[model samples]
Target: QGTRELVGKVAEALASLPPVTVYEPEYVPKPPVVDTSEPLDIQRLDDGHTWLIQGPWLQRLMANVNFDDYESRMWFDKTLRESGLYQQLEERGIEDGDTVSLDGYEFEYQY
Candidate 1:
């Protein structure tokens, strides 16, 4: 059948079918909250400039960083600086200019 004829036949068939009823769910007041604060691991690499940081929260956070955008990169840096991870890494001998590897991405550590 031609395109227009086929479309018209399909439309007619659909028009003869019963109408659909959409189900609406009730509103939920609040969602259950679970603690996600887990410990992180910092391992020094032999390269002397690279360290591996592993943890669920760190992994999830690192996944959101967009290195190509200056604002996004800056926000990630600021967030790290405000968190305990920065101090912990420093305590673990992470120096300025060192690389921090997380979630398959590498970031430079700066004071």
Candidate 2:
């Protein structure tokens, strides 16, 4: 019968379809040798800012100043300026207006 033939053809067509495949990614392990013995380089800049550098890492600290209020801004600036870290950076050749680079990125202390 034509219906039986058609059914056979349909079943054959479905059987001819490619098999479905699921991919699983291979895991890669991290290297065993990593160096962390070197000391980090610290820099202090004028304007109550500090910069710390280690290898490709860098940290910058800036005073939190309230820009909308003049008095709050003044207080924040004064507090940061008196910080020992800020003063040390100033003594270590980082000028008040200097840009520092870490991990290929440049940063400056700006309020």
Candidate 3:
């Protein structure tokens, strides 16, 4: 019953409205622009951490880290420890128990 009343009200409202004329401009195809910019590079942000450039690999790894879950965080840490970047950070003088940050998430480094 309410739906019928709503439909009737909508029809009445539409009937009372003035007509609108839509003007669509001519569609012109734009020339495709070639990419000539340099690719993004990774950088060391601190003694214990480096800034990860946005890429498919980084996105896939970060997608698994859930800050609210302990197990997920542990998995992320283990993954980081197993990766070549861990050795790079160590060579960069990252000490045990030092806080390491990656993509804004911070955690303690352990051997």
Model 3: per-residue lDDT, tens digit, 83-108?
A: 55677666767667766555566666
Residue 71, model 1, lDDT: 67
Consecutive 10-residue window with the lowest summed lDDT within model 3: 31-40
Off by over 4 Å in 3: 1-42, 46-56
Model 1, 81-108: lDDT tens digits are 6667788888888888999888788767
lDDT, model 3: 0.59
In model 3, the clashing pairs are: none
Q: Estimated TM-score per prediction?
A: 0.58, 0.31, 0.45
Q: Name the candidate that leads on TM-score.
A: 1
The candidate, 1 or 2, that scores higher on TM-score is 1
Error of 3 at 53 (Å): 7.3
For candidate 2, the C-alpha RMSD (Å) to the true structure equals 16.1
Model 3 — TM-score against the truth? 0.45
Off by over 4 Å in 1: 1-36
lDDT of 2 by residue, 1-111 (tens): 599999999999999999989889866343222233334466444543445443421122222333476665465446445444345555666765466544334456443
